[model samples]
Target: MKKFKIGYRTIKTAVGACIALLIAEYFDLHYFSSAAILTILCIQPTKKKSLNAIYTRIVASLIGMLYAFLALELVGYNPIVLGIMLLVFIPTLVSFKFTDGFISSVVIIMHIYNEANFTVSLLLNELALMAIGFGTALAVNMYMGDLQKDLDQYLKNIEELYRSIFSEIVKYLRNGDTSWDGKEIIEAANLLNKAKSIAFKDVENHLTRKENQFYLYFDMREKQLEIIERVLPKITTLPVMVQQAELVADFMEELANNVHSGNTAKKFRSKLEEVKEEFATMPLPENHEKFLAMASLYQFIEEMDKYLVIKQTFRGIRR
Candidate 1:
């Protein structure tokens, strides 16, 4: 059997619901348990999402009250009237793009329908319920678990994967080693996606923050990884190791050693330019096989240059 553990969201939802119930009961509001339901619905993983849920629920509940009052007063309080009201009310909410609030609104509509009365006092009571429930949810959801430590670990793991990948490429270029299973490439790709997801969640948790530097950093690495994947076959399939391979291998080793969050792409790009210049002075390939190998090596170098250029264009994450 799979093990289950309660997460922070679960804890927050429980605490918020209990608080909503206590406040509602203290006020002696009729149908006070509805406040707990509202709290449960409003609690979300991110503060921004929770706030949006609160807004949608409040607007839709108010609209539902209006619909209930009109249908009950004009058509009389009957089951058919309730059904017809829902038919029109659901479509109206959908048209207004308030679908998220449908369930909570239905709860409010039922309360008014059960009372069979729509008075100013009833409206005030429902408003109070909304305030207590959504307010409690908002208060509880304000404490988002800090993700910075996890993001930093992800960054470190991704950089280590890059180092391993570069080291493997260096081995292949230097002595035609094919022992490596290229697991680091797959691992890095998966880790980058996971990191980006977490970083995006972190962004959502901060209502006023429009951008996340860690997210941008992972995006940059993902682009570089794409280039690396595209060039891997060319590097591994080189027909023979040429003198230029040694130069490329040296550059790869240096890059592997310096795999970090810092902006060192410019320095590497300068070194790459020197390597390209030296390539121009090297003797022509002796045969077709050597020519093919040299061609592949040149393509690999160009791709590496692109990889560095991607980092160069990125506004790196601050430490």
Candidate 2:
């Protein structure tokens, strides 16, 4: 069974709803309970999302009030008119991309319908309820818990996975060891996906910041992981191990040991150039199998070069 725990969002929702209801009741607003409902709907995980929710709710509520006035005052304060109003209002809101506010707007429509009149006092009461609820939710949601520590942890985890993957590659390159299960590839892919998701949420939480360094870092790693996956078959399926394999294995071991957030790709790129020059000076393969093995190793080196180039282009992580 999954463990049950109340998270920060749940606490915020509960507190915001309570504050909305108390404020509405203190002012003796009609249908004060609706304030709590609005609060519940408006409290979102990120500040940007909460702001968008409030904007949609407020706009849709105003539009719903206008529809309620026209349908009930001109036609009749009856169930049939209410149904017809919804039929038109729902489609209109959807077309305008205000679907998020559908429930909140319906509450406003119901209040006007129950009153059976479109009086100024009723309009002001409904507005007051919206103000109290949306305001409380905004105030409560403003204090989002810091996500920097979580993002940092994700970065560390990803680097560790990358290290493990490179170490495994080094082992296979040095010897024809097919014992490894290659679980690190799958694990790295999954971690990158999750890390990118959380990093994007962090970006959303910061309204002024248009870009997040962690998001960029994870995205770069994801691209590099794709290249790594593509080259895995080439490495493992080499027809025969050549002398150059040991050299490549040495480079892989170095990379694996030095997996970190810092930009050291340039240093490695120079070393890679030396390895390529060494390969060019080596004697041609005497057999077909040796030729194939050398070709695969050459391709692997090229792929590794591409990998380092990707990192070289990226600006180092901010301190």
Question: Which of the numbered candidates is closest to the native, going by highest TM-score?
Answer: 1
lDDT of candidate 1 at residue 138, scale 0 to 100: 89
lDDT of 1 by residue, 1-319 (tens): 9789999999998898999999999999989999999999999999899999999998999999899999986788889999999999999999999999999998888888888888899999999998998899989999999999999999999999999999988988887889999999999999999999999999999999988999999999999999999989988988778888998999899989999888899999999999999999999999998999989988888998999999998877776
Off by over 4 Å in 1: none
Question: Worst lDDT window (10 residues) for model 2?
Answer: 171-180
* Model 1 residue pairs with clashes: none
Each candidate structure's count of clashing pairs? 0, 0
Candidate 2, residues 1-319, lDDT tens digits: the string is 9999999999999999999999999999999999999999999999899899999999999999999999998999999999998999999999999999999999999999999988999999999999999999999989898999998999999899999889888889887888889898998899989999988888889899888989989999999999999999999888888888988999999999988888999999999998899999888998999999999999998999999998988897888
Error of 1 at 199 (Å): 0.5
